[model samples]
Target: MVGRLVIVTGGESGIGAACAQAFGAERARVAVYYHSDKDGADRTADAVVRAGGEAMTVQADVDDEASVDHAFTTVEQRWGVADVLVNSAGLNMSGVTVREMTLAQWQRLLDTDLTGAFLTSRRFLNGRGDRTGDAAILHISSIHAYAVRAGGADYCAAKGGLSNLVETLAIEEAPRGIRVNAIEPGMILTPMNAKAQEDPVYRRTLEQNIPMGRAGHASEVADLAVFLASDQARYITGARIVIDGGLSLMQALGA
Candidate 1:
């Protein structure tokens, strides 16, 4: 992977940060994009350098088209073109039902989780990155796309849309030599889910639902990301690989 360029949105923390580190370990030139976490982004970049790889931090709100464009332009100017894109920026708003969810809240979730992927992928394509068959796009979707929660209507909708988007893009971009795929993760310990992790009862309730009897680590998901972006998955496209550690299968089995 030496000299390959990768751009990871939300790369400052959580699964995104793990993926950045994984790619960097392979000596890929990584662009760590963060929305409001420059410090976290910087720390991730520093870790990449410490891992004997090259990386740079970029600030961009993935929900904003201009910011997305600027970030891709910066990547192009610095690294010429990106070979991989991991769309990992997302948001979740709880306590609002479908009827009670405000317009702003719904829009906010859609803009960040769904539109963000669209904007980033468009910019990456327009940046002339698709000319290489080695280029890949990975979307960090959620198991909520298939599993439902009471107050996660917006989040579920956005992720569900993303899953379909990945399939569509995979088919559309195949002719262009680019592969598109998504990872639908189950409950993972991250800053966004800190409250869930802190609540013992809630945590146990979540773990009980997983056949693996545990939540996944960000690094575990990153491992799949690295594989999917590498030559190992050259023929894999239009696939929504579930990395939920048997949660989906258990759900299917009524466990």
Candidate 2:
């Protein structure tokens, strides 16, 4: 992966930051894209550089087509074209039930989670043009894509759609040598789970539900992301790998 141009969305924090640093460890050139947290993005980019990789920070709203295109264009002008796209930009589930969810709320989550994936993936493909070989697109999805949480209708729906999107893109791009896949993580102790990261009492309560007896760390997921984007996973496409410590497996246990 040395010198490979890689684009990481949501590079400001969490899984995205871990992924940026992990790829940097492989000596890949990384474009860290942030929404608003410029400081966090810069910190992540610095970590990438420290890990023996080239790094640049770009401001992008993954949901906006213009912004996505501009961000990719900036990288393309610097480098030729990106070799990989790691879409980690997304919003957590709004704890509103279907009955209570407004149209705006539904659109907002979908815009960032599902629609953003589409925009970035499409822009990546557009930037590639006729060039294709060993390229990959990885989406950081959730186990809720199938687990169906009561108050996560918006989030669950978006991830559910992302599953189809990944599969469809995999088939469409396979002949072109571009692999696409989804990483459905259960419980990772990122900023998204700030409470769990700060409180062992609360964290243990959730971990008890996971068969592995603990929540996963961001680096663990980042390792898997690195593998998926590597040539080692060349045959792995159109598949969604779960890294939730078996938490989703217990969905039907109490029933």
lDDT of each: 0.89, 0.96
lDDT of 1 by residue, 1-255 (tens): 787899999999999999999888988899999989899999999988877679999998999988899888888887788889999999975558989989999999999999999999889888874375668999999888888778999999999999888999999899887999999998788888897778988988888988889899999999999999999899999998899878877756654
Write candidate 2's Cα lDDT for 12-36 as tens digits: 9999999999999999999999999
The best candidate in terms of TM-score: 2
Q: Give candidate 2's TM-score.
A: 0.99
Q: After superposition on all CA atoms, what RMSD does each candidate show versus the true structure?
A: 1.6, 0.7
- TM-scores, each model vs. reference: 0.95, 0.99
lDDT of 1: 0.89
Pick by lDDT: which candidate is best? 2
